[model samples]
Target: MPHPPVLIAGAGPSGLVLALILLKNGVPVRIIDKERTHRIGSRGAGLHPRTLELYAMLGVLDDILNNAGKIVPTASYDFGELVPKSTMLLLKYHEATPDVPHANTAALNQDRHEEILRAHLAKLSCTVELGAELRSFEQSADSVVARIVKTAEDGTQSEETATFDWLVGTDGAHSVVRKQLGLSFLGETRTETIFALGDIKVEEGLDPNFWHMWNVGPKMILMRPHGVTSTMFNFMLKGRSEHLMNKTLTSDEFAEEFYSLTDRRDVKFGEAAWMSNYRPNIRMVDKMHQGRVFVAGDAAHCHSPAGGQGLNSSVQDSGNLGWKLALVHKGLTPTDLLDTYNEERLRVIAHMLGLTTALLDRNDRGVGEPGKKEFKMHQHGDAMRMLSVNYRGSSIISQAAGAAGAESDPYAEAAGAPVQAAYRAPDAPELVPAGTQGAATRLFEVFSVSAHTVLVFGGDTDARAPVVDALARFPPGIVHAVLLLGQEHAPPSDAPRFGAVFEDRAGHAYRGYGADADALTVVVVRPDGVVGVVASNAEAVEQYFRRILIAV
Candidate 1:
C-alpha cells in the first residue's frame, strides 16, 4: 500500500515554507498550484527579521540575503521630511526590547523572496507541480483525499489524484482550498480604495540608501530604493478615484503621474516589472483548523498593510502552524495541539490590527502622549515582543504541560523556587537573560535549527541532578537534551541522556525559551522546536511525559 501523502495547496510562500519545514523533519509532502509558472510581479516587498531567522534556521537565509535587495532604513513622523532620520528615535522608543538578532525589515519583493525559497525547495529534491489546480476534497476517518488537475506547459490538461493524512490551505486571499472547506473569512473589506503600487526607474539623482515618502497631504506617496540600483524605485500612492481601484494604469499614465507627483517632468517611468491595485482589508478566518485540514498565511488571516504587517504576520502564522503540524505527524503530539495555533495567532493579529490603524491615522492632533504610545506600542511590540511568540494560552500547551507541579513562590524569578547561582556568562545580557550572543554571524547557527530541545536550567548540579538522571537515556530520535549550566561546572561526557551543555554566551536559547534563575527547570520542546513545558520541580517534570508521551 502507498503511504498517504501530505498534500499541500498553493506554491506561494506559505505553502512552500510548510513543505520545506515538513520535509526537513522527514515528512513527505506534495504541493500543487494553479498558476502555470511562478509570479514575475513584485508582490510583497518587506521581509521582517523573524521570518529571515526562520529561513536561516532552514539553512536558506544566506541565499535570501545574498540574492535579494538590501533593505534601506527610513524614519517617519507626521508632517516631517520623509528622508532618513536619526536612529535614536527608534532605539530610544524600543529600549525594553530583548536584543534579538535580525533585520527589523528589508526591501525584497515577493518575486525575489519566493524565488529564493523555491531554490531551497528544489535543493531538497522536491518541486511544486505548477499548473496543478485543486478541485475538491473528501476526508475519511484517517486521511483526506484530494482531486487535482494539471495543465501541461504545452497547453494540455490531465487529471492527477492523491490522498493525504492532512491538507493545508495556503492558496491566498481568494483561496479555493479555504472555500472548499466551507470556512468563513470573518472580517470587513475596506470601503476606500486608497492605495496603488507599481515599480519604476528612479531619476538620475536620488539617494539609494533612503526610502522616500511624501506624507504631508491627503494623498501619501511612499517610494523605496529597489535592488542595488540607484535609478529604480518602487512607489505606492494613496488617494481615491472612481476608476483607481479597477483601472490598470498604463505605462504612459504611470509615467505622467510619476512626474506630476514629484513635480519633475525629467523623471521617466521605465518599463514596469509589475503593477497592481490593492485595497487594504482586515479579515481573518473564523476557524484555522477543521477536521484534518488547516489554513495559514492569507488564507487564515489578512490585515491592512499599514505597517507592512501582512506578509510578516502571514509568515509567522505559517511558522507557528508548521511546527505544530510536524509534531502531530511524528506521533510525538496529538491533534489537540493544533488548536493553539489559532489561540496565540489571533491574539497577535488583533494587536497588529490595532497598531496598523493607529499608524495610518497618526494626526498628532488630539493624540496625547498616551495615544502616541498606544500606537507606537505596537511598533515596539513588533520589535521587542515579536521575537518570542509563545504557545502558552494554547489548548495543547496545558496538555503538553501535563501536571507539572505549579507551586507559586514569591521569591522566585523563574516559575518556581529560586536558585542561588545560575549560569551567567560574562557577556550574556544582564537584562535579556543569560546566553544571548546578540546578532553575531553564528547567532542563528546556534539557536535557529529545528530541534526538540530539553533545557535543564540550574547552576547547582545537585538540585538539577535528578533531571539529568531522568532524561539520560534518549538520543536525537526522541529529543535534543540541552543542559544549560553556568561556568565553574563540569559533567561526565559519557552521561546517559544529556547530549550537549549550551552555555549563555553561545546564543539566545535560554532567553528564547523564557528561562529564569530557578533551582531546577526542565523544559520539553516540541519537534518544531517551540517550548512546550517548563517544569519547575521533579514531580511536575515526571508528570509531563506520563500524560503526553507515556500514557495512551
Candidate 2:
C-alpha cells in the first residue's frame, strides 16, 4: 500500500459506511468492532430521504430499497381501542421527483442495513474484523500507534501493536478513541425519558402493515413491524414503564405486560431476538477531532431517538468525513481540508440535538398535528428529513452568486431552492446526450463517490477550453468534467476533453442548478455530493480547486 491503512475503531453503520467510501476512493481501511459478532435487531429502522440519496451514491440504494419498505403508518390506541386515523411519523410521503428522488423514509432494521454495507465492502476485498478492539492509541505527527486485541474463535486473545496513517472513532457513546483523546462529551442525559427496546415476535392477530402504539395510563408502548410480512417487530416501552424494564427480558413476562397494557390476549409472544435499554442522551462533544485522531457518529453526538435521527446522523457524519479524509491521506489535498470536517459537522449536530430534543418535548406535551392535537405529535418539518441541511457558511465554500443569505437557516436548501455552493447538490433529469446512442441521464447519476464533478453550462468550444484545461491540470481520476449545453446548439465536434456532454432539452439542468443557459456557469460537485464551487468563469473554478487540491 502507498500509505498505512486508515484505522477505524468501530464496525457499526458509521464505520462501515466510512470504510466503504474510502475504499471506493482507493483508500485502505481497517474496520474493527469490540463485539464478538454482528448485532441483530431493528434498533434504528427509519432511513431518511437524505440517507437514501447517500446510499444511492455509494451504490447500495438498490439493495436497501429492495429489502426495506416505506415507513408504516402508526396506529395509536388508547388502551385496546384503535384510533380512527394513523399517520406516518416522518410525515406524509411525497412522490419522488427529478429534484428529490427519495422523498420518503425506508423502514429497514439496523441489523440488515449493516449486513448490506458489510457485503458491499467485501466486494472491495475488505471485511470487518470482529472481536478486534482498539484498546488504546498514541498519536505522533506522522502516524498513529494503536494497541489492538483480537479474540480468536477458540476464545483466546492476542494483542499487537499496529501503525496507521490516520485514526477515526466511529465507536458508540463509550468510545475508547474519544476517551483516549480526552475530549469532553459535554451535555446532560435526559433522566426523564428512558426506555427498553428490543426485537421480538408477535405471532398472532396483529396487522403487520401498521406500527402499533398503545398508551396505558401514563405509560407508552410501541410495536413497529420490522418488515411488511415478517413476524418480527421492534418494541419500545417508554414513560412510566420502569416496572417492566428488567422483567421484559425474561420468559413470558413481556407477554404478560403486553396483555396487561393493551388487554389483548389474542396476540402470542414468541422468542426474543435482541434486547437493550435506551436513555435520551442529549449530548455532543465540544470538539470532533484533535491532532490526527477524530470522533464521529454516536461518539461525536447522541440524542433522543424521537425523529429517528441517530443512525441517519451517524451515517451522514461518517459520509461527510470520508471524502475529506481520503483526499488528505492521498497527498492530493492539504491537511487544512480535514479541519472542515469538525467545522461543518459540529454546526449540523448542534442544530440536530436541539431539533430532536424539541420533538421529544412536543410528544411529552401531548401536542398533536391538527385535528388530533391531543398527543399525536407533529411538526418536525422538512428540516428533520435532513434533505435541507447545508454547509453554506463553511470556510471552503466559494461562490460568485446565489448564496448571499444562505447561512441564516441551517436547513435552508431543499428540492426547489437555488443551488448554493457547500449545499447538497440537486438532481436534474432529462439531459439528452449529444452525438451518442445513449439514453437520457440525470445529474445524480453523474455525481461520483470518488471524484469531484464539474458541470459546465453554456460555454462554447473556445470559451470552455480554459475550464476544461484547468481541470486537466489537476491529478487525473480525482476530477470529472461534464458539459451541459442548450438544445439549440449542436455538440462541439472539436471540443476539449470532457467526461460527458448532454443537451438540456427539457431545461431541467439549468433550472435545477439555478443558472441561465446564456453564459458560462460552472458548478463543482464534491465527491460527497456537495456543491463546492459555483462560479461564472474558469479562473474562479481554478481558484477553488487550488484551495482543495495540491499542485492545482
Candidate 3:
C-alpha cells in the first residue's frame, strides 16, 4: 500500500498487539520479523489480569481464554515427599468482582499467544512480513526511512527501503533500534544466574494440573504443564554457574537430571520440542522514544523471569502507546500527545523492573535457606495484577478541584475505592436504555480505541445536555457520548436522538465510577480505557478536550 503510517520492526507479542490495535483503529501498519517462521516454544507463560482486560478491549480475549490454560497450584517435592502446595488461589479466582472481571492469572505459551494475536491481525487484513530483517533506519522531523533485508527460501537476499510516518521496535533485548538511537540499555547481567529451559513431552504419573518443583541445594527443577496437553511440560532448571554456563543439554541429559534431582524414577521424558540456554539480565533504556522512533516490549526493558513480568510489561507498553499514536497519526490529537507514551510508560517499567528484581533477589536468597527454598507461587497483590498501575499524575488527566486531592502519586490508592481519574476505567453493567427491556451491556462494549467516551452521569437529562452538546461539537466518531441515568429516571422516548443512552438500573455504573447521583459528573474515558478527566461541568469537559484533541 502507499507508505504505511506505522512500521513495526518485530512480530512478537508487543509488536503484534500494537499493529493489531492500530489497524483495528484504521491506522495503516506494516509489521516485519527477522525470523522466517513463527516461534514454537512456551517462552513467556504468565498473563496478568490487567493484560487479559486489555485483550478483551482489543477483541481477542475470547480467543486467548479459549486456547490458554488456567494457572494451576504449584506442588513442591522433597525426596518424594509432598510439601505444602503454593497456589495462586491466595487471591482465589472466585474473588473476581463485577468491576474486575478477570481476577486470576492465566497460563499460556507465548508462541500460542502470538498465534492468537496473528489470527486477529489476519482479520484486519495485515500479515507480518517474515524473513524481513530491519537492517537500519533513520528518522527526520516528519518521517522515518528504514532499510530491510528480505531473505527468500532459496537463500537469496534483497534489500529494500521504505518510508513511514513512525517506527516502533518491538524486537527483544538485543534491540538494534535502541542501539542505533544511541540509547543505553543500562543495567546488570547476573553472571551467577543461568537457566536451561526446554519444552518436552513427559511420561505418565506426573499431574499436569499442577506445577511441579524440586529444590535440592543449589540446583532446582521446575516442570509446568505446557499448552492444553497434560503430557507435555515447559521445564526449567537452575544450577551452579559452572553447570549451566555455556552448556546445552540433550533430551536424555535433561531427563536424567530431572530424575536425579526429584528422585522419581517413574517419570520419563519424551522428545524435546524446544530448548535454550538463558542468562537473566535486568536492563532498560532511560527513555522509550527518540524523535519519531520508539522501542517497546523487550526492547524497552527486560528483567528476570521470576514473576513473568517481561511479556506482560511489554504488552502493556504497546497498549499504552497504541492509542496515542493512532490519535496523533489521524491528526485528531496534537503531536505532543505522543510524548506522554514515554512519560507514562517509563515510570511503569521502572516500577516493574524493581518488582521483578526483588523477586529475583528473593529466589537467590532462598537457595541458601532450604526452608524458604520450597517453591511457593508468589502471592500476587493488587500490584502484581497490574490493576494498581495508573497515570494519576499525568498531564493529560484533569480532575475536578476537589478530586485532585485524591492522590498525586499514580501508584498510591486508598486501599479499596472506586476508579479515579488517571486510573483504569473499571467495567460496569449498563441497562439497555429505558424503553428496551433487555439484558445489560458492559461499559467496555460501548468504548472504542478510535474515540474518547464521554460518560454523563445523573438523573437529569436537562442537566446533562450541556456536556452532550459540548461533545457534539467534535467530529462524530472522535467523541462518543453515553448517558447513564439513575433507576428512577425515565428512559428518553426518542433514544436515537441522543447517543447511546443507558440506565444505571442496579447503580453499579454510578458506584463503580464513584459519582454522586445528586451532582452531575462527566467522565472522559480515553481511547486506552484510562479516565482522562473528571469534570463537574461542560466547560471543564470542553477545556480538557481542547488540551489534547486538535479539533477542539
Cα deviation at 58, candidate 2, in Å, is 1.3
Clashes within 3 Å, all models in order: 5, 0, 0
Q: How far out, in Å, is residue 509 in model 1?
A: 7.1
lDDT per residue, candidate 1, 227-326, as tens digits? 6565667778765345544666766766665455555454445677667777767777777888889888888777666556777777767777776677
Candidate 3 per-residue lDDT over residues 478-533, each given as its tens digit: 78888787776777643454678887888888888888877888888887778887
lDDT of each: 0.61, 0.82, 0.80
Winner by lDDT? 2
The residue pairs in collision within model 3 are none
Q: Which is the leading candidate under TM-score? A: 2
Stronger candidate by lDDT (1 vs 3) = 3
Candidate 2 weakest lDDT stretch, 10 residues: 367-376
Off by over 4 Å in 2: 1-4, 82-90, 240-242, 245-248, 367-370, 374-376, 400-407, 414-417, 494-496
> What C-alpha lDDT, on a 0 to 100 scale, does residue 83 get in candidate 1?
33
Model 2 alpha-carbon miss at residue 326, Å: 1.1
lDDT at position 279, candidate 2: 75
The C-alpha TM-scores of every prediction are 0.80, 0.94, 0.93
